[model samples]
Target: MTTDAPVSAEQQRREEELVERVLRSFDGCADPRLATVMRSLTRHLHAFLREVRLTEQEWEAAIAFLTAAGHITDDRRQEFILLSDVLGASMQTIAINNEAVGSATEATVFGPFFVEDSPEISIGGDIANGATGQPCWVEGTVTDTTGRPVPGARIEVWEADDDGFYDVQYDDGRTAARAHLFSDAEGRYALWGITPTPYPIPADGPVGGLLEAVGRSPLRAAHLHFMVTAPRCRRLVTHIFVRGDDLLDRDSVFGVKESLVKDFVTQPAGTPTPDGRVVDGSWSRARFDIVLATEEEQR
Candidate 1:
């Protein structure tokens, strides 16, 4: 019978020595968690380099690409997040931390466009704030896993305009197409906004070049981002995608989840809304109930 030859002592020693040297470099890390993370990262990174037989030119090119990505990042744009999203690292990290539990809404990527201190509006108030699109009504309840109401929960929402651009994309630094609303005493919430439409993630930077090189499309499925938080409950960062958006099957960032898809029922002009809001033309409505995991469940 044929058998493989054993690794020579000299070669095995050299391989071990390389890894050991890297680990030893982090031996003085004061934080236990940081040390563990750095050690693990070193092992995998070295393994990847060895397995690919990476050349010096390739390493230099990778460094240059990362540097370019950083150069394009600014207050309004986040190229590193775009890179992580395209590489599936963002989604993988979310999956590791957000396991399903008790029918709570499944979490998804918090895209790079989110901004703090969005203007607050009451239920049935409009959040369009000048940006144009087909008006949409979003209504929902914030409830605990056991069907109990989570009164006074905060719900922050944001979405791209019909032109496939977020508020931050504008040069004037104005806010539009986003709002912050709170649930009432009965855990009910509603607000008016624009219907979501399929859009491409920003593609003018190094990450975009990488996507083009790999023959991948940069389109993200139509969806509205929601961040719901309540007392003593886990905060949920998720998106409610349009049920029939063509891009749903192949979201560029792989953020689409079956549980998060919902129907956006279209209504013709003059349709009356529950909150007595007037509609001048065709509009859409989406009902998305958020189930928040309790503190205990999160543990």
Candidate 2:
């Protein structure tokens, strides 16, 4: 090896030593707060690189891939989140933090496709249009564990088009299949939408490249996304997955939880949805009740 190269053995040693020195900087941290977390993260991350014998070329490629993921973020999209989803990090975090949630309501990864301030729709409204799936009506009651009603509960919902693309992804305005509804006096909430079909997550960018490199497929099971928050209810961001979606076990994000999976029922066509959209025979129905942990419990 030539000594004149940009980096030599001595240079590599010096660089790794510098990393070690930087990692120890947080030692004896009286706060034991952020510093503790930061130092542990540093140790594990450095160990991972060493354990994998990560190469310079691979590191550079990883940096470039992350840069590209950041480049795709916009007002309506977050590529970093998409990357995290494909990496299974997001789902893991959700699972770790929500371990105590009972059979009341299951939480899942909130994808990069959510649109806040969803258009308001009435109970029994039809959220799906131009769908080529089953026919059914979604009905459920939002309540606490004691089965007490939760009135005026706000439920924000969204789902992919029949083609597996969200309205925002297609650059469509806040339209059908994405709306917010509130629980009625009975703490009952219902909506009508098409049966969901397994769809691929974004696979045209750096995230896609990484997935391909890792031999992982970029597919999410058919499901409906919901974020429910009320004054007294512990907020929940979850999905109702299709019972038999082909991708259930292989959800690219690892976002599928057994409790979150729901049975998709089919009803007759031309059934008048509470929203006044006549079901065209191809629709699906799901029922999920949300339970709230006390505010103090969440804390």
Candidate 3:
């Protein structure tokens, strides 16, 4: 037989007291929502430490790794984003925020290479700008989920060259392989660009070290990035992966979606382009139709 005894609040352990102190620190936060988030973050972080029974050496190593990531980051390179991508944080956030909705194009990561103020091009113009690769004709239409055409829509497109490097990666500082175009009265748009090619993320940095440590490849599948916008539709950022890409099953950033893959039909040399442009060698063509979610749907 055992006698029952009541425990007092004074019996709280040191770990429990520390957690309570951190939570109490959030009490003075001016914003209620921020306070709520801080409270949750404090609880989760402390719990993680407890669960892992993390040692001081491990904590210091983590701090050093993050510091190195920050040191390598700059205006053109985003080491933090690469870190988040490799850690699956970026993709997880994207998944939580962009659940699939009826026929609206699926969203993906706005990758590290994106830059503001890309040059605009007319329909049928070439965005490759002499980048080395086989010519590819990309034609598509912008429409709403209801199947109505979205005239005057703006579409920004960018891709890596055959060598798997973006325009910004070169020391020359000249832009190529990217352009912005407007939809026609019938919502049709077309432009010429280089065929998409697989490329590894910058491997000379801390993110690369982390990938190597974990035995993860830094290669992303071949794809074309697009940012489409219309007056009443939500802005869509996405990618169209090349069909039959070997890396589709293992995109380093976890950015691929089945609906976004499309066929890039090969055309032999001497075939007339849709816009009657002269081509001396083999070329390719792909057609992708974009559907936008309405403002209400976005809300």
Per-residue lDDT of 1-299 in model 1, one digit per residue for the tens? 11244557896689779999999999999999999999999999988776666678889999999999989998878899999999999999999988888789999999998999999999888889998899999998999999999999999999999999999988898899999999999999999999999999989889988999999999999999999988899989999999988899899999999999999999988888777777788999999999999888974
List of clashing residue pairs for candidate 2: 127-177, 134-282, 134-283, 135-267, 135-283
lDDT tens digits by residue: candidate 3, 43-148: 9998887666667888999999899989999898999999888778888887777777789999998899887899999999899987889899999899998989
Score each candidate by Cα lDDT.
Answer: 0.91, 0.77, 0.90
Worst 10 residues of 3 by lDDT: 1-10
The best candidate in terms of lDDT? 1
Give the TM-score of each candidate: 0.94, 0.86, 0.93
Counting only residues 3 or more apart in sequence or on different chains, how many pairs clash (N, Cα, C under 3 Å) in candidate 3?
0
Candidate 3 C-alpha error for residue 260, in Å = 0.8
For candidate 1, what is the lDDT?
Answer: 0.91
Error of 3 at 71 (Å): 0.9
lDDT of 2 by residue, 67-176 (tens): 88778877877889888887779988887776664445878898887776777878877666554345457788888767788889998888887778788766546465
How far out, in Å, is residue 179 in model 3?
A: 0.7
Window of ten residues with lowest summed lDDT in model 1: 1-10
Name the candidate, 2 or 3, with the larger TM-score value.
Answer: 3
The per-prediction tally of clashing pairs is 0, 5, 0
